[model samples]
Target: MPNNIKFVKESKSKFLTTKEYHGYGQILKISDDGIEKHIVVKPKDPVFGITIKFLETGHPQFSIPDVSIDETAIMLKNLEEAKTFCREFYERRDEFVQDAI
Candidate 1:
């Protein structure tokens, strides 16, 4: 199993007019019952926070404080859904990273 994965984000602050950025991340885990779990660390703003919210199906969703800059929000129904979302997010993130590099 993979040990750790780190995702980074870099951007220029409009107010500061300088490159300012940060990262959002989570910790992966396999439970004793052989269930995959994600222990989210620094969640994205306005979507995910420190607390973990689980549903009846054992799925999880988190919320960030005020980062979206819009009324729209992000959510996940299950681990698979979360994975799909992360895949898309990373795909876009990679594009941005490549452009930055």
Candidate 2:
């Protein structure tokens, strides 16, 4: 995770944003059920690699990999592409989410 990065909700939007650090990205909450699902992006390395994750909340951590969920990533090459895709993804969330999951 990037240091000092915090998520703040965008005005009239369902997603969150963090300032550019190594890379920039968005956080989209996709579920409100028992185990909330959140889609977030973060840098994979020294600022270039971008990784998107489909996160499940309210679940107890396991010692080993026991369970799994479907469709957990939105892979991108660099910060620029990640930034562009974040915009596009936010604009077409419904379409992208359907394909993503």
Candidate 3:
């Protein structure tokens, strides 16, 4: 991931821009659920070389500490929002890692 890269929403559309680090590429997916946004990212594990990790099926963290339905998730209603969220989510945190085996 390139540092401080910018993503812009088109005047009447949306788009995604990417940057390469070492040799890994970035990917983003955005979705809507009538009331919120969902941004999902699959990044290559730096410690394991360029092996991009993935989930076989389902929300990879379905077994995390249970919470009430009031829990909040970052909502990305479109492509541009998703791209921004991906950049922030990956870069802003160190211990907040999300992974599934």
Candidate 4:
């Protein structure tokens, strides 16, 4: 957690279901000076997704698609190109799946 971070609650409506929900989030702490900072959070798993945190506060700014399958495929292809590259790089790789980006 950064020193200049704060959490905020937001009310949002669920699409289709038409239900309302309250979510907790954080963002960079705003100072009296009125300056805002940029915060970026990258999830470990590109396929699952990533969360972006605003620097002005610690709250989550937004979520991004992981596209892990696509990215990992590309990575695997690149690794294959290098014959000397160890195949172990992708073996038993399930543990590396990241839920956030």
Candidate 5:
């Protein structure tokens, strides 16, 4: 598991708060799911932050040595579909953040 995780100087993972393409930044807020761990991603911009419980497949094994959302956990079957959800959530960030405040 440790081998899969990227280490930054100050932050934890390399993807901790970085946007993949020419997009706004993002942060990975991690959560525990009993035996497994999950994550909720938050955008750096003033968009709505998202909390997600992973819908995962397969089982954990020590021989695997690493884990990741894209590889292990799944919210949507297609990558493009997942991005769509993020964009839509970001658009409504104001409402979500406001209510939380």
Candidate 6:
């Protein structure tokens, strides 16, 4: 188990909040109790283009380094399908940030 989770930064939106764990290179959405969801944009396996996982609070895999795809995960074939899933289910939006410009 990881002794600690080092977060580099966090971004909050109306729909969800994301935290980037240092050295992990993945964005996580944690609930008040524990991790709720996470997205792996560039998975090591080309077969699974983007992996979106919805984990229950206090799940054993929460603290593990291995990536387990069970019934709660949806492996999208490509970026476009992943975006569509987010738009429909998560209601994602493309917002322009002035500070980033």
Best by lDDT: 2
**Per-residue lDDT of candidate 1, residues 52-87 (tens digit):** 344213354544344453533433332333454444
In order of appearance, the predictions have TM-scores of 0.23, 0.30, 0.24, 0.23, 0.27, 0.27
Per-residue C-alpha lDDT of model 6 across residues 1-101, encoded as one tens digit per residue: 22222345666666666544322223333322123344332333344445445422212121222334661243423444444433432322112111111
Residue lDDT tens for model 2, 7-68: 23332224432222222443334432223334545444433345554323322121111222
Q: Candidate 5 — which residues are off by over 4 angstroms?
A: 1-39, 42-76
Model 4 poorest 10 in a row by lDDT: 17-26
lDDT of each candidate versus the true structure: 0.34, 0.37, 0.31, 0.28, 0.32, 0.34
In model 6, the runs with Cα more than 4 Å from the true position are 1-5, 24-36, 41-101
**Tens digit per residue, CA lDDT, model 5, 28-47:** 34333334344344433322
**Greater-lDDT candidate between 1 and 3:** 1
Best TM-score among the predictions, by candidate number: 2
How many pairs in model 6 have backbone atoms within 3 A of each other, for residues 3 or more apart or on separate chains, i.e. clashes? 0
Q: By TM-score, is 1 or 6 better?
A: 6
Q: Which stretches of candidate 4 lie over 4 Å from their true place?
A: 1-39, 66-101
User: How many clashing pairs in candidate 3?
Assistant: 2
Clashes of each: 6, 0, 2, 16, 2, 0
RMSD, every candidate, angstroms: 13.8, 14.3, 15.9, 17.5, 16.8, 14.3
Give per-residue CA lDDT, model 3, range 26-67, as digits (tens): 343333343443444443322221222232222232112233
lDDT at position 44, candidate 3: 30
Candidate 3: C-alpha lDDT: 0.31
